[model samples]
Target: MTERILDHPVLGALEPDQTVTFTFNGMTYEGRDGEPIAAALLAAGVRTLRHHEESGTPRGIYCNIGHCFECRVEVDGQQGVRACLTPVREGMVINGGGPLPAPVRDWRKNHA
Candidate 1:
């Protein structure tokens, strides 16, 4: 992936924001504070978020308004988290659609 620094025509001289470090697929990446996860990933040249669970098809940020679940990712210990709606935070651990935590069964299948 190529470097994706934005050079906007209308918003000349983009100001740098407070940066926060977040891990994506075990790799550290820098993102602006309060920025959406998808925007941060796109700026870093990361197009694919995860592969379809059934077909293994690559999925990326689509309908960035949080209408579509194409940008779902695993964050910390949570599964099926929507990246487009989530803000970038310091020390966030992100996974590239890896295996999710097993579903809760019988309300206490494993807890009991």
Candidate 2:
């Protein structure tokens, strides 16, 4: 993939690892198996992992590590999963865009 790093300075020459097919938002994509879900998603040109629950702002991989919760996604019907810490697996179903919170909409509507 064009998004993937073919070579790294410290990591040496990058070689193709086992590829796994996973679905994101109902679209199928291929990624290196066992890599962080965040990396796989990015390599597959997926930037916005999910939207903020309250604000509805687009969220993505900010830290690339597990510290930041920006990369939250739904994995296998589970919500609030951190993609950066989770490994890519075969046939995994990931939902990057979930239903927006109704409270925000209701609050805005009522206030307006």
Candidate 3:
């Protein structure tokens, strides 16, 4: 996949950040170091982070301040992590476009 470029009229050509490789939904992608996973995914043109378990509805980043769980994704073997809150790390494995288990929803309800 090609790396995304954002050219802002006011910002002009901004210096690129250091990038790290991470996998999203079995496909490899690059993300900037120390940035939010959602930001990285958005930059990479990933619009659907996960699907609703029951309705199979697509969901992506919303209420970026971490108030919403719309950006939940699976990292490594762990599930239901908020992409908006989690920083992208080198070699991180992100699994998107899947259903959240019941335990994940229960945990989010109590903790999020």
Q: Candidate 2, clashing residue pairs?
A: none
What lDDT, from 0 to 1, does candidate 1 have?
0.82
In candidate 2, stretches whose alpha carbon ends up further than 4 angstroms from where it belongs are: 104-112
TM-score of 3: 0.77
By the lDDT metric, which is better: model 2 or model 3? 2
Q: What tens digits encode model 2's per-residue C-alpha lDDT throughout 1-112?
A: 5498888889988887889999998899998999999999899898999886656778899988788888988899998889999999999999976546798678876997
By lDDT, who's the top model here? 2
Report the number of the highest-TM-score candidate.
2
As for model 2, its CA RMSD to the true structure in angstroms is: 2.8
Return the TM-score for each candidate structure: 0.79, 0.84, 0.77
lDDT score for residue 2 of model 2: 48
lDDT of 1 by residue, 1-112 (tens): 3254557688775577788999998889988898888888888889999986644579999899999999999889798889999998999998877332346333345566
Model 1 residue 43 distance off true place after TM-score fit, in angstroms: 0.7
Count of clashing pairs, candidate 3: 0
TM-score of 1: 0.79
